[model samples]
Target: MQPQSADGASRDPTKVRRNLTYDQCYYHPAPLTRVHGQDVRTRSVRRQARIARREAALPSSRTAVSTPASSGFLGSTSYLSVFRETPRLSKAPDRSLCDEFEQWRTKLEYAAARVVRLASAIPFYLEQIRWYYDKGRFTVIPAPIVLDSLSQTVAHMESHPWNVTGNWASIYSDLMAATKSPLEISPNTSARQFNSLFTGPHLRFEFIGFIFAMAGLSVQGRFPGRQSLELGNGEKMDTDAFTTEMVLACHHCIEVCKQNSHVNDLTIWMRYMHILLATEVLGEPSERVYSLFGDLTSDIYAMGLHHQPSDHVPFFLAETRKRMLAVSHRTDKNLSTAMGRPPRLPHRYCDEALPLDLPDESLFEEKDSLERFLQRLDDGGWNRDGKFYPATLMRMRHILSNLREQVLELSLGRSTHPNYTKDILATYKFSQTIFNRIPSRYMYTSSCWKEMDAIECLARMIVRLEHLFSVLQLQRIRCQENSEATSDLLDTCLEVLSIVVDLTGQYNIHEIKKQFAWIYLLKPRSEVIRTLSFLVSWVRNTVTEAQPSVMVGACLELNNVIFKLLDDALNYRPPLGSGQEDARLRSVDTGQSFEISIQGTRGDLPSDVFNIGLASGESLSWLDDLDFMQTSSGLSLM
Candidate 1:
């Protein structure tokens, strides 16, 4: 790994900077493009930076922050503490950027007419995404502002399509030689003001990527599944087609900005925005997902966003940077825990605080809008007016995500430092304190959701799951270290699994389970199953080590709860025939193996580590069918 300066990015000493060797360069240009011809085991490329400006306008008072609901689960944490301090491997960002397909390497240059055709849809795309769309904190630029920018770009492209792009290529060729300054925005920057920063007739490639990306999301939202989805242009395509089209467009536009070493909010934003989409469509252990995540983290570090921004940075840019980091960092921790891969954006390097829990609109709506909203905030900076903003969800999730990182260090780090475990336990204690402080409105309540709209109900469900999922991941590791733990694998495992079942039994998540839309929301379902299935093996192995009578009873009785839960998940579905659910449930009675994609391994476990495939047969017969388990004399099917 290339050593970084005090700031996240390091400058090259060579005659032509940005020409540093892939091994020696801490920061490279883009996530998707590689300087060297091949993928390597370690991460070496440096990325863009985020420079912020204001923090004073935000409310200084502390209050209870609100959160949203949803759950996630993890697989085994059975790997013992093998070292004093774990040599955490950073596999995610290390090779996350390489895509060596011979064909895709060629740059795509669309004709003027084709560019116009796509540009024309920007307004339509902006509207559809904004329509009842809940542009949560995840989406930084407001629909109206993006729409305004698109209108200008489209008009300019219509008359002189070749003119703008030609000028663009020549102008940016110079800036690519060395690192560039970060994009800046005042805290109170308005729609017009923001457009002035990036919008031009040249139609910046990053912004172009942003437009098409937004367009793709709108299409995805409407027809979320892989089956029978159609773009309004009258072509019927599956989810993968949409994803491929979006990804290609992202490549076409973003490749230039990246090549030129241009790291604006738009470039970084588009890269992170597309990570999950590409992962779902392409499938996980996905190189595409890595490319996007790598780009996101690379951009963050290059921007020096890991450090707290000075008051000199613009407030709007600073807050935007914070929000973006929160999203990327939260995701980094998530991928780390799920795969046991080291986190790319570790918390130790990230000193930037979570963005204030104010709506994006509050910063731009009126001259005094931010100040006014500040007064209405609860002590925790949450909006207490009974309205849920995307910031509220991100803020809550950030806290949980940070906790997830701490949990990882404790369970996986295996530190020999004095009172290391005690320090971890202390953090665990603080977790409860944090959860207790969350506002009541955002807390999960099974009885209360009946009155809310489907979307609102879903939002609240996500909040709960997010919190519970974090707790469950922590507990699974802690319990694994202590064999004396009860059958429940700590209460969180059961709770996370239960909520996942309820998603099918009680709500519409089954309806929206597509890789195309809400990948994070849909991800936990597979993760929850994976975690519980591993628990079966963990419990079975643990009980076998105990007294004979205890082992027999434990194997025969204790696992019933987990077995039942797993059984419920395998069989439950949201009554098929809508979108892709039909295919998932089709031929259930055929007694064939269910094929939900499973990836990688936890330690030296068998290649068939996860036998979660449901038999759909009566009487739990599939449990007997497991081949690898046959060797375990003490473990029994009955």
Candidate 2:
């Protein structure tokens, strides 16, 4: 049941304006220092506290240096407390709904919400997608439709693509200019028509809801002061407001498809047939996704999925368990980084091999087929001809996660403790070795994407960005006087930022990346982006008389560039004062503890954001680069 417009299309798509939290926001960048809902000054306090806890957990430093006389009859266990399970202080459990939602409108309120999270058959994962799109019943694609639309769009565009020899807007004029959906698609659509269809609104709401919004809004709308919600005047579809809004719009659409709201067998059968004709696609917006992640990893240890399965298990079942362990391990590291916590599944305790790199087809086929597939695999067990198998990325992710865990452990360790490893160079070299050892076939380049399908290409790009990002992240902690990263590392960091900006500007990759934005390093959240931005801060903060880093010159602009890129990407201009209300439901002193006037804007504080003072009387030629000017972009983000 949808509300109809004068044209008879539905109107409920306006729901995108509400429920911003249920989906990830692409428009506003996440907060840098206060992501964990802590004061900016408390980051170091938490790190020190985390280190203190670890030190208290272990035996004293005296145990490592026991004298021969002291060692006689005096063992390491002499001072140890007997192992015991005791009740400890616990914190309040986290709730997904606000204190308000405790007032559920009958069980139907929860029944409707639960339908989106659990009862839905469609997955939010990349491996499977919304396969059942229908015209009025279901706006997402039908189960039978594959990559035909993508292929047809490829056919519409000129062969010279922007990623290669041309940009999408340059080769096609209508990219930022479309005003209407076509009655029909064209292999030879004019530049204006194509751009309109390309950057213009696609139906993002479900069935009736989606149909109306696409008609009304590139996402046109009104603001608090009657200011126009303007799209950028180019092929770039990177507006933080629009992109973030559309992402939420898509999240709900996917939920509707997954919940199978139609709830019947005959309709699904008919929808499958209609896909032979056409289809479109999108997530519910929820921070609860991460909350659910915490629940999942906790349950993993409960179920002993962290350990290898019994030897008696079948190959498929054993492999599936192994794969889950690997993915969860990697996911834990990422979540810990963003949340400023320790990883749940540390690599040192886990004992299991990566899942075999075989496609799903080979596993389901006859026994000989599985064996033949195994025999043809490369020495490293990679699929031949750079083929993509589900396990291919999984295996790589496991290996990388193992290294990432170690890196994070070192970064969070008690460096001042006597037992801490002093050999930082060794850790640096180990990271390099692991990164280099990645399978050559998994290396990604936009040019080589022609050989593989979209998922495989996107997967390769994702892993590569992750590899580079982790390297820079490790550098932030280790890039000190004696163990500095070379200029090449800075080059890679710069490349990462550029690629991220360019990604927001592109159509094809941007759409795919937005779907799983919360997880992917390329589509990394605020905290991860800060790691890249703060590399210069790390270099400067180092207490050293050692020669200034070669990167210091380039780093002068790093702060502004990083903030600008993110500010534009996430449309992250939040309210200035602690008392001011955030458009987002979150309540972090997210805007920082700024003192503001009666007006919503800043008054006491100057426009200059960072107040940096150098100890030495060096000429700061790039002082102007640090000017943190605020943009006019609206505030709406995850």
Candidate 3:
């Protein structure tokens, strides 16, 4: 019998078998003579015989084979035999390969679960650490261990293809992307090319990773158990246990890269973030914080980031470098003012252009486009095209930097120049212009981002207050020589104090408590307290009235606000001492007399107020009760 072709034509059974054998030999290409003993029949016949034998040796259950096309001989056993023989043509799966794949899947699941668990606990850890910080029992733990554990887990997850699903999955993805390194290139590559490809990405990744981790920890702290709460497990985490874990984790993060000797921009940025968190949120001593700041400044100069970025550098990278310097400059200026230290990054060292007032997305799209846009707006002022919060901050920071210098000169009695007052007025006017030009969107009252509104408002308020303080300081210097300037100085000081009280009253105790967890509030809070205390002492000494009037009412309002705001764990007290009393009443003649006292009960006054300036060596200081001033290492501006 002959097999029928697809066209329904009959063919010779012998010829069909011969063609099938030849086709199998061409496709499979196995030595058929070795499998089957030598026979006098042709090669095709022998090959067909060998295939038939192999199929027959298999069990009945495995006889059927699947094919993509059909060339049938109806009810013919010979055709079925050829199809079954084709099944043996391909290689079989090895048991070892299956086991290896199973092992990999299992490890991948384990790694993913571990990473998720650790990342999930980050918030709880932050809360615990904050508790310790508030209690002044903060202890440093090794950060490398925790980072190493997380790193290994991430590596494990990277080895397999597994779906990561959750709210934090995006953050995890960002972290992974930020930390990813490029493939290693051959050593024979040119040094310049190698530097361009490897150096920037590696450093950018480290800085970005550090930022992501810190941000993750911050988010966890800010929104505790929100993720688990959404899971509907109804499982509540213990506050104490989680807080302890967070404290340990934070210590680890802050100290992880401390031992690295190769200081770079990434390391400098990491330290900058860490220092801000430690000093501001954790309330670490200013001396320790400033010491780290000193180290960071050294790194900045070493990398030449303090200078204007060259055209050879990528625009995005150059801008980033400039932003880093700007931040460093701001940090140094603010801390120097706060701690009464000479700024490490002086005006001479800071020749870099300010960061452009462009949105991150626009700059990210094409660096060259941004460069061209920036060149067009070369007046070195705020770009009014968009509402950029960071640019506004940098602008305010620049004004504050100038204010710091002005205040410094005035404090040190070095403001004897003829145009000193004129310069101060010009700077003040510039700050006011910038403040007015700020888009309403960035204002706390007008911003759509309510969550960040309070912080934004606080920053703006601080900058304004600093500007006012600078003017008041300058006027006080002028008043020393010309008593005619006394009334203007007093008015400016009152305005500064009034703004602090007004802003403090806007937020309830709960809102203020929440703001305390953030670093931005630290300096502003300290400044407010110090300024209020100064005003209180000034008013009591200078303003003498038979009855409590407008100035007296303002003084009382400020006292109430400060007492309420600082009543928490901070325990801030007004500076009260005979030295301060002497300084305030020193110019008064023997014929002059005035009564001075707080209007509240004994409980309203800080116990330290009575003790402050009581020592013979003590003298009246401006905002001297600030934490930095308490340190013996503080630089003497006076």
Candidate 4:
């Protein structure tokens, strides 16, 4: 065999194989190789410069303060070390320092708990505000009651502040007394003690309350024309009371949330806003909502301001949107991100769909005239709209009559991409669904409305299937280049078509058989011959693979369908002595055979007669006697 270059020029196949070209690029690269070797050094220098700039920009207090080993949550160990050159501070001397630190730590914990509780109530008030805004009615309950409850909740948080700092202090003291070595304060012990003090249950309740508050606020903003109220201080608010308050509150909370050291508080705040914003997007599109998007984008951008370009906010938003959309009741932030991306176009199965061009003025004229005729049928009797009614029918007929012409025009010869075949298969599948939904009774004898509906469905399905066939043809040609994968793709396309046959049901079997017959008869001109062979093989193989329970019925129905196509072929062209050589040959077993070939051996290949015609009476008895061949081969059957 001739060798080939990556671009497909003939060379030595061995050399081409050894080279293993990838993506049309040549490489004899070694491992650990850098693409921009000199740039790496420059980048490192610039990174250090930026770090220096950042450190220089820090406040004097932070710059001046460098903590000793003892400054960590664990007590200082330098004083206990045996090899230390400098004398460490004694425990007695540091006792006062430790006390002051403990007091400050307690205050921080109390502050955090207050923030969490306050944030949790945010969601609920938001909802109340939305209710008041959208309902155009305020709760009879006084504003004093709401304020009282909020104030009480805040006070409760202050009283019940988590004593995590105390717990950490106790754990450190215990570990210091228990441990023998300076480095023996195990992380596991610290984690266990921390978990004992602040469990996940507490985290969940706090986070949930925050979400409820945010949701409440968003929901409250929906009503238009709701009257605003003056608080006890007699301050008249002119703005949309709830939204304005919620937005401002959110802005303030966001700022405070920045100083939050605990990840949970920040995470919950982000989640609450996300839910609130999402709620707004669902009911209506607003300019205010667009500002929410801008804020969210800015926040994400700002968070990664000092990080690498890999921290792209849009990228995270895109991915998070995918995940958030799958879950119900996500935050306003999540919803905004979800709404950020453009909506995807509906899936297409075939390439031969209508062109991007708008339908010509003539089609519109025809549609208008058809509608007028339909109106007459609806208003006066069909007798009053005589010519118009018939004219509309003629137009319908014209549309249905052009199905084949349209499919032929749309066939995409051959494509090499996996998408080509996959798209074809998808199109085929979608068309099958629409075609199956078309009512069988309406096919041959229904009113104009019914016929038009069925024809439209049929036309669309046929167009899609045509595109699929084009893709399949292209795949077959490409198989010579990459047989293993392309062959599997072809098989998948065949499987899809088989499914189409099953969904066609009894009514559609006839129309499909006639269509299939037309295709096979057209041979190379249309993909009929290869398509028919694949279908027959699929039916035979599927029957062989069927379990004993359903095998009998599946085989009978499949054969019945096959026989109908055979019958169409028979009528189109008879047996050899039946006057036409084509007709006679069509009914004979000489046209095609199913055979298996063995590689690397000179032996006779096994053959199976794949005659598509009827056998002798005895052979036909089992099938016909089973009464499976009663349906006619027409669109009415579909």
By TM-score, the best candidate is: 1
* TM-score computed on alpha carbons, candidate 2: 0.43
lDDT of 2 by residue, 464-524 (tens): 6777666665555554322334344444554564344323323245435444455423332
Better of 1 and 4 by lDDT: 1
Q: TM-score for model 4?
A: 0.22
RMSD of each: 15.8, 22.9, 29.6, 31.5
> Highest lDDT: which candidate?
1
What is the TM-score of candidate 1? Answer: 0.61
Which ten-residue region of model 1 has the weakest summed lDDT?
Answer: 49-58
Tens-place lDDT digits, model 3, residues 343-439:
6788665784667665433444444775666664436456645343455576556645655665555454345778777765665565356445444
TM-score of each: 0.61, 0.43, 0.45, 0.22
Off by over 4 Å in 1: 1-101, 107-124, 131-140, 155-189, 224-239, 415-420, 487-490, 501-505, 508-638
> Candidates 2 and 3: which is better by TM-score?
3
How many clashes (backbone N, Cα, C below 3 Å) per candidate?
35, 27, 5, 40
> Candidates ranked by lDDT, best first?
1, 3, 2, 4
**Clash number for candidate 1:** 35
Give the better candidate number (1 or 2) by lDDT. Answer: 1
Q: How many backbone clashes does candidate 3 have?
A: 5
The residue-by-residue lDDT of candidate 4 on 376-443, one tens digit each, is: 43221222322322122222222222222222222322345556656444544543454332223223
Q: Rank the candidates by TM-score, best first.
A: 1, 3, 2, 4
